[model samples]
Target: MKPPTDTDTLTAPADATTVENPAVGIDQTAGNFSYKVDYAFDAGTGLSEDTVRYISSVKKEAPWILEFRLAALKKFFSMPLPTHWATKDLEAIDFQKIRYYLSQGQKPKRTWDEVPDDIKKTFERLGIPEQERKFLAGVEAQFDSEAAYSNIKDIVAKQGVIFVNSTEGLREHPEIFKKFFGKVIPTGDNKFSALNSAVFSGGSFIYVPKGVKVAQPLQAYFRINAENFGQFERTLIICDEGAEVTYMEGCTAPKFSTSTLHSAVVELVALKGAKIQYITVQNWANNVFNLVTKRGIAHEDAEIKWIDCNIGSRLTMKYPGVVLKGERARGEVISIALANDGQHQDTGAKMIHAANHTTSNIVAKSISVGQGRSTYRGVVHIPKHLKGCKNNTECDALLINTNSRTDTYPAITVRGDKNSTQHEASVSKVSEDMIFYMQQRGLTEGQAMSLAVNGFINDLARQFPMEYSVELKRLIDLEMEGSVG
Candidate 1:
């Protein structure tokens, strides 16, 4: 098939006021868009020991990895669905009906032209290549369960930084990979995490050498092309002592009549005096169920931060977390979630203080439109022995309509003396009077609403990279277009 042109992939909604300039390339104007692709190999529907073995065999994984997969598979089957969680829709996922893996069965290519046409076109629409050329130091593009393209700038690679798909990282850097693999986030941490461990496919593995500071960000983009499929990507990032690195990831899937599943496990490790920033922007189709487990460990004087934005999905339950394992370590979480129509976004942060003189912060914002529901669930723990520990958590929700719903459940356990902690939460609605005030200035109701919502998350949005911030604002504007009557 001929590769699709830019015009073919990007379809602007009729009501869209802004046409995304290709220069900035992350197009927020494209609405519920998708293309067809043929898979070279597909592990037929259902999950079992056979399916796990098939996936491992296809990847030519090492024996140890295979053993891990089998053990995790057993755990997945034994574990029950999280019925007590905020998202009751967990009962709707039919694990037996979803394809465990789908891939083109090709090694990652360094050049865009060498990438499969259909897959290339998909990333082209998302502007992955262009973004790599402009700002990113390294890029990995995952298409339906595997990385189709992975490359790093020669200059950065020469600096002793390793950025590759998890498959290659396991094969090439077993020593480093094994030391921290599943150490931060164990396979049995949760059911979804176990599922990801059992059938994990393409996700990025990054290692920054000691004392090296990567000035530019490394990125991975995941796209799901098959229907009724389960995408399980495992990502691990390690920052050595005195090292600093920033990594970003984005995901999207086609609109399918039947539900699709995305379950991923991400683990980050920051050694003594190191720093790591992990960012994620997920815009899955409304029929997709996104359940993920992400956590990091910060050693002595180290830092770890999670910047997350969730926009589109039938249901999303993710809590990016951090463990301060060494004295003076720091962690922060900045999150923004928007639930529209029939969607539900359940996301928050977890901070576990295991040492003295540690600090943690969490700032979360959510917007609910139509009948959508947005929830914030978080946990902060400080043991009795820890001193000089501090925590601050703030959660705010914005309701667009009367039917819209919002909930906040924060669990804070503090047993230490001389440790300071603060928690704040507020829920508000867009008042007619505010809209009228903006309308008096000749702005339409939709524009006013968009402006209001943008202002609500402006602080958190500013925390995003410049390019992403622009696209995020555009997406918010698009979501606000028809929000009000």
Candidate 2:
């Protein structure tokens, strides 16, 4: 595989302003890129009891954590790769050849200058620090298997909001960490979940105090700088009663001849009257298999929302879910996926209405180019005892080439007489007439295709924060560069 070229480098002005309109012009040069870095420690390759013990010892984790990891490892080995469905290419993953963990010995730096030069340059190119200074209330940066830099604004910290890496949070606030860790999504939920639980490393841990609202979003960036490696980060977010917070995460990896793995587990808790929003923009290299499990619990009158955008990966299977465990709880999932040549993005959402008067919504958009494929698998359930429950799901797919493919599988179960459920799906190809019309207006075919794709997800993109929305548009344009003849 070739290293990233200059054209792939994502460059932005230090003071770049966010664009509000999707149709408006964006910096076409802004794109995703990757580079390699040296590591202080590498767990060689393969998985075993010794590997697990080595990881635990390196982190100096508690005895209980070590026990939990060993148990989860046993579970992972006992289970089989998903053979029922979506198993055609999953068998290709060579577990024995993949490195489980790799990291530098440096602790997370509070100041930019303290970060290692190579890692700092990588984050600088990604604009993590600049975004932190401009709008983010806090930022955590992970390179390979550990956090490299973490800092929260002083004012936000003074407000009693705790934003730190998972390791620190567990070491410093065991009371709060132990209460919710693995509570939302258990270790044995699935094969990938078990794998993550066994080898999880650096991820964000946030706690919003009661009644405090974080006006600005907190951000985290994960970069896989090594080849043929796996990144397993565990994230947990807890919101106390009457508090509100929004968190966003981004991920990327370098192109490699061999496959890389990214399996993460994210759990969220929304207490009574609290609100939590989680957003993710995953732009991995085509040689990466991105499998993740994310779920949240919403208490009475609380809300949980997941805004997900998937752009590149060899194969990605993720479905963020929410359990409405209290009356009047609400859950929403807004997603957009783009699959170019040789890529497969299978993504969706799940909503379980366990309480009366609960509501849920799912809106998904997908685009397939060349021989790429996109699939949407969703589930919404309202039991017989639940009353006044409502669910609405919509899935839309756009194919930009003759070889592009898409599939939709939505299973909705509503047993209660008073509950209501609605599902809508559409599959369409880019119209040549629209391309011709745009070309007549002095735009290239590629630009026309990009514009049409952008228009399809314009409404949903508006739901994202301004900065991310702008970056999403630029990424779309970049993907559409060679889509059309």
Best by TM-score: 1
User: Which tens-of-lDDT digit does each residue in 383-444 have in candidate 1?
Assistant: 99889999999999999878999999999998857799999999988888998999999999
* TM-score per candidate, chains pooled: 0.94, 0.93
Candidate 1 ranges with C-alpha deviation above 4 Å:
1-24, 27-31
Runs off by more than 4 Å, candidate 2:
1-36
Give the Cα-based TM-score of candidate 2 against the true structure: 0.93
The prediction achieving the highest lDDT against the true structure is 1
Model 2, residue 16: distance off in Å is 27
**How far out, in Å, is residue 427 in model 2?**
1.6
- Please list the C-alpha lDDT of all candidates, in the order they appear: 0.87, 0.87
Determine which window of 10 residues in candidate 2 has minimal summed lDDT.
1-10
Collision pairs in model 2: none
Error of model 2, residue 303, in angstroms: 0.3
* Shift in Å, residue 475, candidate 1: 1.1
